[model samples]
Target: MKKRIVSLAMAACLVLSMMVTLSACGGKPTLEEYYNSDAMQTIITAAVSQYEAQGVECSVTASGDELRYDFTIDIQTTEEERAIYAETLESQMPADYQEFIDEAKSIKESVSNETVTVVVTYYDADANVLYTQSYSSDG
Candidate 1:
């Protein structure tokens, strides 16, 4: 009877472990959820510091399936720098979350040379604009 109980307990443990593993493999979080995540913010902050050259102020806002990253650089960044920044942002997206970026309804990025305002807007899958915000530079 003792041996039988031990075997049964081991089987239960195995089943519980499998259940936990399966739940962990569930689908990734939505873009809106990830927008507020520390991981995303850290990645964006690092990328901005890398590309801004001088200095930048950044703000992030998110609602539902929408996310906005707004930043300002001290100087009027060159087009090359903007391209690099965008690419770096793309690369920083976690692999599992890349699908959210790919399937987004729209992505709009505007950088102004006159005032050094940067605005990035991302729309949800339903064609609704998630959010729009602005960034400023010191210069």
Candidate 2:
């Protein structure tokens, strides 16, 4: 009887340990939820609204691991804007584009001269990545 009791106790301990190890805890963070999340979504919407006030058209899109925030703006775009922007962005420009460009290329690459930060989330479940969502938050 003593031996039998000892064996049963060991078995219970093993079973309990196994169950604990098999259980999954919490959840993986995902981008879909981040963009869809009301809190984060609201922040992005407000920022976009402010940008729209400047006559810029923009929207946020996320798919898989890719995240994009597209924006287009209309400006009087005098030589002053380009000159000022060029001077401001001069230090940051890559060696390739450091030289002068034709008017067409200058206008095309102008927006690329600016930078913005966006925060996104990715979620995983059952050892598989579920979805990704992205949104930009105001600093």
Candidate 3:
């Protein structure tokens, strides 16, 4: 009778350990699931509103585990001005660029172990592409 009780206890422990392992592995959401979550939508909406207040049209979209930001300048500019703007974009990023990247990485890590890439594209007033840049979590 004592041997039977010991065997039953051991079996129970094995089952409990398996349950724990499965739960730990399945707790994290996929990239697409997190991207479509309400919390992510709130972040995107706030960002869009802030850019709109500055007279720039902005949008965020998901592209195969990557995030894309598109910003359109509202004011018309001459070719020289556009050239200068493009040069500036290539030289330096906005002050909040790093912050944005950090937040993206943090959120992605929290949801899953997958890495994320962020792409930024700037458009002129006439819808012509002016500049493009990308940031990756791998670095």
Number of the predicted model whose lDDT against the real structure is largest: 3
Selected candidate, larger lDDT, 2 vs 3 = 3
Q: What is the alpha-carbon lDDT of model 1 when measured against the actual structure?
A: 0.44
- RMSD (CA, angstroms), candidate 3: 15.8
Q: Which predicted model would earn the best TM-score?
A: 3
Clashing residue pairs found in predicted model 1: 72-136
When 2 and 3 are scored with TM-score, the better candidate is 3
Q: Rank by TM-score, descending?
A: 3, 2, 1
Better of 1 and 2 by TM-score: 2
In candidate 2, stretches whose alpha carbon ends up further than 4 angstroms from where it belongs are: 1-25, 75-139
RMSD of each: 18.3, 23.0, 15.8
Q: Per-residue lDDT of 13-67 in model 2, one digit per residue for the tens? A: 5534433443343332244443454544554566567667777555766444334
Q: Model 2, residue 91: what's the lDDT?
A: 42
- Which of 1 and 3 is the better model by TM-score? 3
- Expressed as tens digits, the lDDT of each residue in 38-113 for candidate 1 is 5445545554554455454555565543455655444444456556655665565445253334323212111112
CA shift of 4, model 1, Å: 60
